[model samples]
Target: MSAAREMLCDTARAVFAEAAEAGMAPVEAAGFDLLLVPEADGGFGGDWGDANAVLRIAGVAVPDLPVAERILSGLGDAPKTLHAAATVGLMAGAMGQALALSIEHVNTRQQFGRPLGKFQAVQQSLAVLACEVAAVDAAAAAMAARLDAAGLDAEAADFEIAAAKLRANRAVGIVTAVAHQVHGAIGFTREYDLHRVTIPLMRWRGLHGNDAYWAERLGRQVAGFGGRGLWETLTARAE
Candidate 1:
């Protein structure tokens, strides 16, 4: 990355970490949204650029304290209860899934006939978990970008947000499953936190729309201009 990009990422990481910490408190912090407010909101206005910057940091923090909900809620006139619920749901689900994976590794991983988190495979899983976390962070950033540019237009911004949530939701499953398999039998235990993320991941999959639903929606969007004729229509419209 360029020096400038690196600088921005570093700055965003710092602010996001602070925000994430505040978000984890027993009570929500004051003016949390103001830090990421768009100019239209009468604050130091920002766009997806700002939101993504914040989200990437928040993902790193993964505090599970409803940080994303509060941020998204503060953006407009008030967000509906359902909207806030969905926002927080996705963020919470993502964190839960990741945590579950870690717990699974630590418990089931046996090395030298003991827990393998005591060994190498478990360590590898941890690395993979980090990558998954980073991917989700990037997805959050991308979703914020679409929202900033397009507002809440269903075809544009909503679609992008849905896509992001969809990917994160699916990832919750993939990460959890693989981690559990690697963990062996102990991952199924009620004593594990892995279940916490697994339960939410399952719920989130159906909460909004699933992969097939979103895929169809995206397909229809591409086909809306007249199936294969969309490109022609676009060219003609441009002309």
Candidate 2:
């Protein structure tokens, strides 16, 4: 990340942490609602990359406070596709937190006179969880880039948005299962921090759109492009 973006994320981390305690008031006071608007329009003029970064932090810190809605408010009458793309970023962040919490639990919780992290089964579960989290993170990043490249036009970035949301939705079952499995029954308790991330991830999977919805939408877009056109378009978009 660039220096500016690093600073932005740092600020987001702090602001979101406070928002978690004080509700949307802290987020609104921080001006995240101007995240995607242009400076000429009396806004921050930050791109989707900036919004993605802030949203990811919000995903982990203030998952229930309408952070995504506030951030996307800059776009009047935004399409569902854009909201779906934003949800992917939030899911990615929450999934990442799930993995982090799972790892922390496994390393600390003891079983059979040894730390759970020492067990092969626990390690394997964590590895799988890590892969899913990485996939969602990659999908979210790609979607954000496509949205930025398309000037935040939902129609132009529909394919990426669909794919990202589908990828995130698909991973939810595996990620949450593996995270909770590794953490055992303690994960289900209200006192644990694991619930903070896992619950939001489950909620986000159905928010914006669900797995089947995005899967079919993605398939239609891919079929429209056909085999060769799909590859060409993918490469062209990457370029």
Candidate 3:
């Protein structure tokens, strides 16, 4: 991460920590809605990279809050795909949290006079959880990069948004399952923090775009591009 982005994320974490206790009121008072506004317009003049980083923190800290909606409201009007992009970031964070909890539970929970992490089956499940988290993180990062390159135009970043959200949506099932499996029945308890992120992840998968919704839309987009044109467009976009 760039020094600037590291600082931005730190600030986001602090703000979200406050929001955890006080609710969205602190978030509004902090002016996160102006995060994407232009500097010339007396705002932060930030881009999608900044938004994704901040949203990641919000996802981990305030998963139930409307932070994505608040950030998008800064634009006044934006393409629906932008919500998908924002969701990828949130999903990445939530998946990461799930993985962390799973690892901790496996390391601490005893079975057959040993930690669950010592067992091969538990290790394999944790591995799957980690892989899913990494994939979602990569998708979120790539989507933010593409969105920034496109000047935050949701239409221009539509393909990336769809692809990232779809991958995240698919990962949600595996990640959540592995997490709960590793934690056993304790994970499902209403008093446990595991549900904090897992539930939101489930909700988010269907929020901006469901798996089938994105798959069909992405298929249509690729069909429009054709094989050769698809390769050219993808390569050019990477540049």
Best model per lDDT: 3
Compare the candidates by TM-score and give the number of the best one.
Answer: 2
Question: Global lDDT of each model?
Answer: 0.55, 0.88, 0.90
Residue by residue across 1-239, what tens digits does model 2's lDDT show?
97878998998988888877888787889888888889999988888888888888888888888888888887888888878888888888889888888888888888999999999988888889899889888888888899899999989989889989999999999999999888889999999988998888889889987888888999999999999999999999998
Give the distance in Å from residue 135's predicted Cα in candidate 1 to where it truly belongs. 6.0
Count of clashing residue pairs in every prediction: 12, 0, 0
Taking the tens digit of each residue's C-alpha lDDT, what string does model 3 give over 85-148? 8888898988988988888888888888999999998888888889889998888888888988
**What TM-score quantifies how close candidate 2 is to the native fold?**
0.97
Consecutive 10-residue window with the lowest summed lDDT within model 2 = 18-27
For residue 26, model 2's alpha carbon misses the true position, in angstroms, by 1.0
Residue by residue across 68-115, what tens digits does model 1's lDDT show?
566666656543322422443355434545655676657664566787
Clashing pairs in 2: none
